[model samples]
Target: MNHNIIFQKIETVDLADVAAIEQQCYPNPWPIKTMQDCLDADYQCLKGLTELSPEIRCYAFMMIGHEEAHLLKITVHPAHRKKGLAQAMLHRLTLIARINHARKIWLEVRTSNDEAIRFYRRAGFEIKGKRRNYYRYKDHNGKQIKEDALVMCYSLI
Candidate 1:
């Protein structure tokens, strides 16, 4: 990652940019209200940006509690990808989870997202189990599709 890239807790001012990244990255992005709710719930949220601007190039949402951390979402904008931003965000989240005394960090990924699966695996996240039909979305033809979610975990201790 570039040394100029900075990571900080996301603020309200960053919502629009964060929403745009979500829309661009996911076919079924989380609603703005949901993001707001995460903020309201005081979830662990971080935005990654360059020092030259306030625009968020990447972000992550994780909830830390009960001896574990659950990664709710993570994304790096398409234009800013391939520059190690996503990995940096993941590393930051892992560090935060460890600092909070979490025994493990967990995330669920859509089984079809092969790139993300590989990325998590490379980061030492193991496939622990599956959530059957955990995700539902529509295809280009407007047909509904149901997909499984793979539960992955990284041990912190």
Candidate 2:
């Protein structure tokens, strides 16, 4: 982890950079409209940028409600993997949630995504439940395939 890396609120100015990272990180990345919706929504969104380049390296979208928050998404650029950017983002989200009076944080990840599961577990998130057929995607044959999702939660209490 580079302790000196800079993290900033996801402002409108950083959309293009954020979208680029999002596309690089996910198989089915959110569209520009979805990113815009997240920015316009009542959630707290953030971006992690390198100190030298000041380009978006990672981003997180979280919706805060009364004493709880749902971590909608967190993505790190493929080039920035294994550098603790995700951990830093999660840590920052915990702090932000605590400051916003959130007692717990929750999120869902694809069950087949072992790397992400390990990452969340290392960050203190525990498996809470499973969401069946949570991810639906069309295959090369144009048939929809359903994938399971693991629901994880972390207590900020």
Candidate 3:
């Protein structure tokens, strides 16, 4: 773990750079307005964790309700991936969730993303179920398509 990295609540002003990182990380990402809306709606957790001299290299958005937390999105910049950033952020979020009385944290990942599925498993998330046609995107030829999503959850209580 990098001692220099710091986690802070995300702000609307950080959305542009956050959007750029999102574009780099995902095939399809939530729009900037969507992120802003998360903040405006008082999502349970919206944090940006900085790395390597205070740049916002990683971020996450989560919503906690009725003793459960839903991780809307979590991302690490390409240049910053793998160096314990994701795990560290996950730790932070889990702590926050537990502190807020959340018994578990949940998220949906694209089934096609094997690496992410493995990573989540490594981080103690268990595959709970699958959602058919959970994600939609255009293929390289520009044909629209849908992808299944794997539901995963991590116990916090």
Candidate 4:
């Protein structure tokens, strides 16, 4: 984690910046509305900013249920890749989950996203199962595609 990075609870005013990073990080990004809905539902949403600057460089969303927490989304800006920003946000999320009494933290990653899988593993998450056709998106050619999601978990207990 970078010493200069700070994690802040995401607010409505931060959506545009987080959305921009989302658009840049994934093939299909969540709309600002979806993020708003998560907040409205009392999910934990956060944005990462540089201590010296207010720019949002990364963001994450997590939903906590009885004895578990699910990481709905976590993203780092492309330009900030390899700088430990993602890990910083992830660590913060893990702490929040633990504080909330989650026995484990779960996340689904696209099977093809080896980079993300590796990162999760390094952060103590284990591959638990596969969710078939969990993600549906249109490719660049406008053809709908379904991708399997690798369910991963990090146990706190």
Candidate 5:
């Protein structure tokens, strides 16, 4: 783990690298255009850079509402995993949510993604509910499959 990881606001130009990491992190990564939409008015995108290079090693995309913040996605570059980058991004997002007057932070993770679920729990998020067939993707055979999602929440107030 590098102790010099730096977190900053994500820019449109950074999307390509962000998208690359997205593909590696999920079975169904958001399309590049979809990730572009995350730059809309209500969303906040944060990325982590290390050692003065312009490359982003991790990112957190979030949507902010009147009283809550929703974590749309978070990912760590494959080479940067186990380096606490995700945790750093999560903490930065939490502070951003609080600064925006949000009372809570919310997110959904694929039920099959136990590692992420554990990570979120460690970040103080608790399972609040479940959504059936919340995510759709193709399995190894290329057949469409749907997966349940675990809804989780964290208090910011």
Candidate 6:
């Protein structure tokens, strides 16, 4: 764990680094256009960078509504995993949600991602429901497959 890591808003400069991490973190990572879309609107996104490096180590993308925030994605570089960066990012996001008058936060994680499930559970998110075949999978031949998604929610109020 790097004690000198800093968390900040995701800027255009951080997108390349984030894309690299996103590609490695998810089987069907968001495309550059989607990332741009997330950045172009009234959404909330944050990046984690190391004091010694110019690259982003982790990133979280969230959407805020009237009284709830949807955590769209959270990813940490494989090299920097298990170092508490994701938890730190989540903490910051929760604070931001609170300041925005949000009473709850929601997110969906893949049923196969046990590590993320544990992390979210430890971060105070509870399993609320499930979405069937909510995630897309691609075969070597570019065929699309589907997987179940687990819905998790965190109450801030």
Q: Write the per-residue lDDT of candidate 5 for residues 55-139, one digit (tens) a residue.
A: 8888888999989999998888888788888888888888889999999999999999988999999889999999999999996
- Write model 1 residue lDDT over 1-157, tens digit each, in one string: 5566899988777788888888888877887888888898999989998878977888999999999999998898898887888888988888889899999999999998998898899989999999999999886678998989999999999
Candidate 2: where is the Cα deviation over 4 Å? 139-143
Residues forming the 10-long window of minimal summed lDDT in candidate 5: 34-43
Off by over 4 Å in 5: 1-3
Please tell me which predicted candidate would have the highest lDDT against the true structure: 4
Please report the TM-score between candidate 2 and the true structure. Answer: 0.92
Residue 47 Cα positional deviation in candidate 4, in Å, after optimal superposition:
0.5
lDDT of each: 0.89, 0.86, 0.84, 0.90, 0.88, 0.88
lDDT of 6 by residue, 1-157 (tens): 3467788888776777788877788888887778888889958888888778878888899999999999999888898888888888888889999999999999999999999999999989999999999997795579988989999999998
| Structure candidate 1, residue pairs in collision | none
What is the lDDT for 91 in model 2? 86
Query: Per-candidate TM vs. native?
Result: 0.94, 0.92, 0.92, 0.96, 0.93, 0.93
Window of ten residues with lowest summed lDDT in model 4: 20-29
* TM-score winner between candidates 1 and 2: 1
How displaced is residue 155 in candidate 6, in Å?
Answer: 0.4
Q: Once superposed on the true structure, which residue ranges of model 3 sit more than 4 Å away at CA?
A: 44-52, 139-141
Q: Global CA lDDT of candidate 2, please?
A: 0.86
* Collision pairs in model 3: none
- What is candidate 6's TM-score against the reference? 0.93
- Name the best candidate (by TM-score): 4
